[model samples]
Target chain A: MAKGSVVAIDIDVSRRLGDRVIAAHFTTGPGLTALFGPSGAGKTSILNMVAGLLRPDRGHIRIGERTLFDGATNLPPEARRVGYVFQDGRLFPHRRVRANLLYGHDLAPPANRWMSLDEAARFLGIDHLLGRWPQSLSGGEAQRVAIGRALLAGPEILLMDEPLSSLDAARRGDIMAVIERIRDELKLPILYVSHDRAEVDRLATQIAEIGE
Target chain B: MLSPEEWGIVALSLKVGGVAVLATLPVAFGLAWILARYRFPGRVVLDALVHLPLVLPPVVTGWLLLIAFGPLGPAGRWLESWFGMTLMFRWTGAALAAAIMALPLMVRAMRLSIEGIDRRLEGAARTLGAGRWHAFRTISLPLALPGVLAALVLGFARSIGEFGATITFVSNIPGETRTLPLAIYSALQVPGGEAMVTRLALLSVALSLGALVLSEWLVRRTHGERQRRGD
Candidate 1:
């Protein structure tokens, strides 16, 4: 493993969903690491563990020099500073787009807030949607807002859990462009989960196959 | 179209109902959240205890309250000695009875809404750097608002209609504990007070109907919001 790696995850965790036991174990380093696997292959579970949303029954997670989880320490999700864009954009229904974008931004400490709400909205091309409600936005538009919301939180690493899976082909291309810009311009490390071979090949600097 | 005395009864009813709902709101939400989110030992018993007042006879509930909160009882004695307060035969005691009776309905409504909320949204909030309490307050609480409002209205309606328990526990003091139902019952005891009884009963009916309608509207609104969100 490179000492300068953006994220280091060597985790073994199993979750019982009904009678099926979904378990995962993998490790990746630096830049954009793609977890490629079919559906129900526990790809999202890995992203969840990285984000501290799911605990590993064993092993450890390290992002940069900080130890997120291990036998001796387990940091909660809020303290982990991981930006997650879910398959379904989980925007708060009660808040307007602007409020949703700023929800995490406001909670992040002043020094950690690298992006302003305006900058994020403009970057995601959601500036006109500030006054709109989450329920009214299109699927693609909602995902952009979700991305912007996550970025404004100033996370140490981004976790995209099949974010493009729910969009149309055109919208997928558009979001893929956005992700490419994020990879190149912002240099933010992303742990992307996708089964799309083309998407993984196009966006990933390192690929880790799961359940192969 | 009521006299000053009748108006006083309406005011007292509103006060008691409002206070009962307000006081019970936090306790109901807490219990509802617990019931909705966690599976733990004695959960069934806790749930049953919450619903006990709903099933128990109003008079029995009143008797229990009197025993527990009366001047001679342990809680009653503690309140009297420590806080220089008394509940026996007072409006506060009437409000307490109303709160207890209204609790189960409030908790049931709140729990349903809380349970209906997607836990994933809370997880999203957590990944956004919100602590558990912060995420719950901003996400789960707002999502559950309509249900909570409906619960409050339902509880208020139940409190205003509280009759047997209020009468048995507080004995329907003229101005203090004589809410709408109690006043109507009191009017029935007097000869030629049938006219007053009829007027008060009609008012009670209207109040309850309005609350029911409002609660129904709130519940529908919640469903509509959820549907629009594609949930």
Candidate 2:
């Protein structure tokens, strides 16, 4: 791996879904890597392993010289400092936009607010939505909030799984701008996932097509 | 024709059942999450046993309660010695019985709601640096609010109508333990107490209907919010 490179070594994981293998072999790399494939093609599984949500049967994940997952040294998601944004933009429904941003801020150590709550909101164009409940947000708006929340945590690397796949065409266009802006503004590396060729071309710096 | 003595029973019943439901909500939520999200040995057995009270005759449940919470029982004895508190024949004892009876209902409702929540949301939380408990409090708990409210209402309704278990475990001590159902049963046995029975029965119907309407309104209101968000 090159200096400051994010590398995911050969990974093998399997789960018996009533005698059938639900997931199998998976491996990939960093720098806006795209896990492009059809539904149930094990794309999400690969992302989950990288995020430490699913422990791999055998593999290693290293991001920017930090060992996130290895045979004997497996770090929990929080400790790994790997930020993951899901396809559905899971904003805390009860919390105000500002509070949701602060939630991630609070979880990070008190070193320096690398991305302050105000900075995150402004960067994501969600400053006006700081006081509104998530229930009041639009589909595209919620995705932006989810991304802002992830960024505010000051993670070393960000993983987004089809962040725009759920939005309408218009909404998808609007969110694409926010996504591109964040990618350029933040020095941290990102691993974005999507099966849409247009979206993959638009955002990804490198593409790793799965099951192709 | 309910005398003031009977009126006292009405208030006592509401007091016990209301407090019991209130106490069960938080505990039930925790247990429900454990059942809904985690996989562990004996989980199936634990799930079945939680519903045992629902399947068992209320009388049998009452007897078990009596044995376990009677003055001579171990838990009851410890309560008396350690906290100078007594449960047998007290209104608190009736509340305890109602809570046990209502617990499974609350857990079931919460479990369903928790299951409905997207696990991917939780995954997002974990990557955002939330610990397990923090993720639950901030993400899971909020998303499952509608279900939690429904559970509270259902548990409260179940506690209010409980009769056999309440009567058997706590007995019908008029001033201390006799709740609405016990009072209605006692009134039925008296001569010329027809008017009182009619009044109490009406009250029960009114209370239950009010809860049902409240739950419906709550469900509609939350559903609207979710739809608007999706839009």
Candidate 3:
């Protein structure tokens, strides 16, 4: 595949769970590319490979001009400059919400930093909740904090791994609205993983259906 | 009340134990991090080596320390030649013996705490552009602190009560290597030394018991905090 888009994931990654084979080979462009698949279909695995959390068994993942992973050059996760919002809202428990949100900011190079902590907090509507620890936040509030955290790093790309999977239906829309605002306001590429068809139908600009 | 000489014994014990633990804490934390987070070749062997003191006879452990730390020994020779520091038959030697005997307990407590931290938090930090050291400093180290504190207390308790290793490695020398346990034993060797032994034993019991209770309370507080956070 040509290294043309702002983000590219034309790679083959396979995971064997006892007897089942969950494999993916897909590419995405500038906008939101949703990996829609059933449970255990390895949607998150693909995202992990892109984020440099898991090295792909074959093929390559290129974001902008930098190749994150391939045969020899498997860039470490910290160097990937890709913000990830995990489904479970993996906030640092000991840290206050403000600290969690600002964690990525210190490491992002001045050139890559497109936003500040205050801006992220304002955009995510998390200004009032900054002083509290993560354990106290509601699901929707936690997800918002997680998003703000990823965004503060000023990543060129964002990866949402079933970000709303753990939330109740009532809170899902609140987070969805925040995600939409993020997409509309930011110029970064996004790879959203989800099992919900309706969510993909609503937010995804491109769809790659994984699993045989 | 402890007699003047008895008071000296108690003071020496506290000083030796405190210095040993304080001296070894940073090294213990480094080892704990390695043991808890990494899987390298001979990992099992390294684990066994670290816990050897816990399973081995303290006298045997002291013998090992002596072999490595005596003035004629290679390590001891180098240390003595370079820094004028001799760790045999000195009060410093007793502290060294105490630290070695107590190391496993300290490392174990800290390692358990380090392992308990949600590794994904470090992963998250990494994705945010934080390097390994930065992630460890800001996330893993802070999260593992209570356990580290508990480890220090446990090490101190073990240090103060260290007997076999202290006796064998440094020997019981007053104003030098004779700590509380050695003093107790020396008192027992004489006829009218019962009262001295009794007072020293009671102090030892109190110190050990206090350390254990403090460690237990810290562990429980950490657990309670986790539960409160719904983690």
Best by TM-score: 1
Worst 10 residues of 3 chain B by lDDT: B222-231
Candidate 1 docking DockQ: 0.54
TM-score of 2: 0.81
Across residues A48-70, which tens digit of lDDT does each residue of candidate 2 receive? 88788987666567664677777
Give the number of the best model, judged by lDDT: 1
Using lDDT as the yardstick, the better of models 1 and 2 is 1
Per-residue CA lDDT of model 3 for A134-212, tens digit only, reads: 8888989999999989988878788999898899998899888777766666756788998788888888888888888
Colliding pairs, model 2: none
Per-residue CA lDDT of candidate 1, range B29-133, in tens? 999999999999999999999999999999999999889888898999999999999999888999999999999999999999998899999999999999999
Cand 2, B chain, TM = 0.94
Docking quality of model 3: it rates as medium
- State the fnat of model 3: 0.76
**What is the alpha-carbon lDDT for the whole of candidate 2?**
0.79
Candidate 1: residue B195 lDDT (0-100): 95
